[model samples]
Target: MRNIRIGDYLVEKQLITQEQLENALAVQRESKGTKKFGEVIVELGYLSEVKFAQALAGKLHVPYVDLSNFDIDGEAVRKVPETLAKKYTIIAINIKGKRLTVATDDPYNFNILEDVKVMTGMDTDPVFATRTAINKAIGKFYSMQNVDSVLEGVQAFSDMNNAEDDEESKDRVESAPIVKLATTIVENSYRADATDIHIEPFKTYTRIRIRVNGDLVELMNVANVVHNALTTRLKLISGMNIAEKRVPQDGRFTQVVDGTTLDVRVSS
Candidate 1:
């Protein structure tokens, strides 16, 4: 979909009440005329500058620019090796017959694209998106690829480490419950590709936090009290008393990523 402004989009999406929007609009019309929603929102105190930026970003459908995208010039991608491109998660999004559309928050992504053109002899077009939007889209693309399933990938990793079979590892596959939970989190995380897992105290709030390359790229506030259930389940699996939370605890478990099992530590 083409980019749309977040305030207008949210109003259209029914995410904010019409009255609230009207108030914001009224302030904007009075204080600033013809300015973008972001600027006006910040001036009128409808939202904090950071939040306004974030919302405006939602409207812009671009990830917030950061050091990662800024560091690589898009023009250089034209000469960058395809092997390196894939390894680096560098890709052309809108590839047509002869021309490819590259979406990135970084202007430098275009430089990279230019480098790729010289190396592979492919025509490329550079497009810009917010870091958040690009990461969200990329995560979806990778999930569709399904390079590895969490359980199978973890088991392979364990064997690679020559880790002997233990009760936990042996029953890992058999315990459909734990596997299912881990798989859901990992899959959802990959889909959103969020940086952190937001475990809030809300009853039905399941927010997935993804930070790609060191920025908070996506936040999926899923409306289902999945956190309570998942946290409880995790506590039980880790041999912690589910009913107790007065004391802070630390524990960890292993899961697979990219055909390798990696340890995922839990902290409260």
Candidate 2:
């Protein structure tokens, strides 16, 4: 954070391209040095604000705040004086005996947060957020009390209420056909108590098998169309490069089965 630039980090992480960075830099230059590189990239619709903040949090080792699901406390808002809040571009989100949780865009500005901890006589926990979200909190709790600045809070609240079913529905909607199929295959393997699920690609068909009790048991065979999609989906879930078939990669993820989370390892 002190020496490495954010753009290079994003590019190295495959979150953005070098071309996109150059274009954002051009936009920043054209702004007469007014806009920050991140602001330019976000304003140009190159990346979502939440994702940007998440990457920044990972790089800076700060906590990321998901504003869509945050519940603002009115008392917490008042703990930080309106003048200081606006001046430092921060908003208090929660407060305990002598510990205050605050959201701010600039986590590097430790002076402002130190002053806040001193003024309130409390320890401070910092969370990262987009500039806009902090402003919405300020508006909803401080200056513009009557403004409807929920930022999809109603929808998010409903999601929280029906979280389990809602999460499955949302995952289904976001997942491709092959992803869903891959999920089903893994679920079935879990139910069957299989040690390994194997998918082998052939010219015209694909063979699916499961290893149970040290024996490979035939599962099913699928046509070319299904096999291609299944292969791509498997690569995606395993965090492998689907574009490169010759490369060997390894990745692992956790899957919940019958209310229990299980680690599922994938390799190719």
Candidate 3:
């Protein structure tokens, strides 16, 4: 699957006529083969990776995914061997029920789908992604096991705070838990390259989601009590009036993470 270039895929799928491929190939051959077929074709304004990814989605009848900022699940990642994942340019992203969701650059390869199913003993749902994306995902997921564990622990801080509803003590009533939760949520989202961190209040609880890879994925859920405090903290940090909950307000604040400054907007 690693060698299955987009040019062959386009030709095989009839998205690119053979004459077009042959012409592109001729250009490459004439250049002393210094250029790739897809490269020459793209340079000639015939195709692009983004357009090709869209076309591939149509050809395979599968959803095309942008893997940028996609947080790989650690448990799901451990289900498949890293060697197999790298060789096929595939990433095991999620597991739910009896289904294992795998993202890869080659969605047309039915063999890869079947192999993962047999190997993991879970039904494999193949998601199409760019080759560069698949490679990056695989590397990121396998490279830092310790960092992943720390993130999970940080997430637990919020959850542990929520479970103390019956305490009603100074600790539970204090802003420390909510502040810690808010800080953790922001830092985690920043690390994951999230476009926005959504803090939504739901009836008796709260749902925290982050925009990553153009998709909204749930990060955590905590008690509404915790969310209230967290919301106030966010408003204050963003320079919004924290007491005015009924009226919608928007403000932004800047933070420096790893030497890069980022602006975070808050609204309600």
> Could you say which candidate leads in TM-score?
2
| Candidate 1 all-Cα RMSD | 14.8
> Candidate 2 versus the native: TM-score?
0.51
User: Model 2 clash pairs?
Assistant: none
Instruction: Give each model's whole-structure lDDT.
Output: 0.52, 0.72, 0.72
For candidate 1, lDDT tens digit of each residue in 84-186? 4444345455445666555543334556766657766778665554444444444444443442454354444344432232223334433554355456566
At residue 104, what lDDT does model 3 achieve?
Answer: 79
Give per-model TM-scores: 0.35, 0.51, 0.44
What does candidate 2's lDDT look like per residue over 67-97, in tens digits?
6478867788878888788888899998877
Off by over 4 Å in 2: 1-3, 143-268
Name the candidate, 2 or 3, with the larger TM-score value. Answer: 2
Root-mean-square deviation of every model: 14.8, 17.8, 10.0
Candidates ranked, most accurate by lDDT first: 3, 2, 1
Residue 153 miss distance in model 3 (angstroms): 22
Rank candidates by TM-score, best first.
2, 3, 1
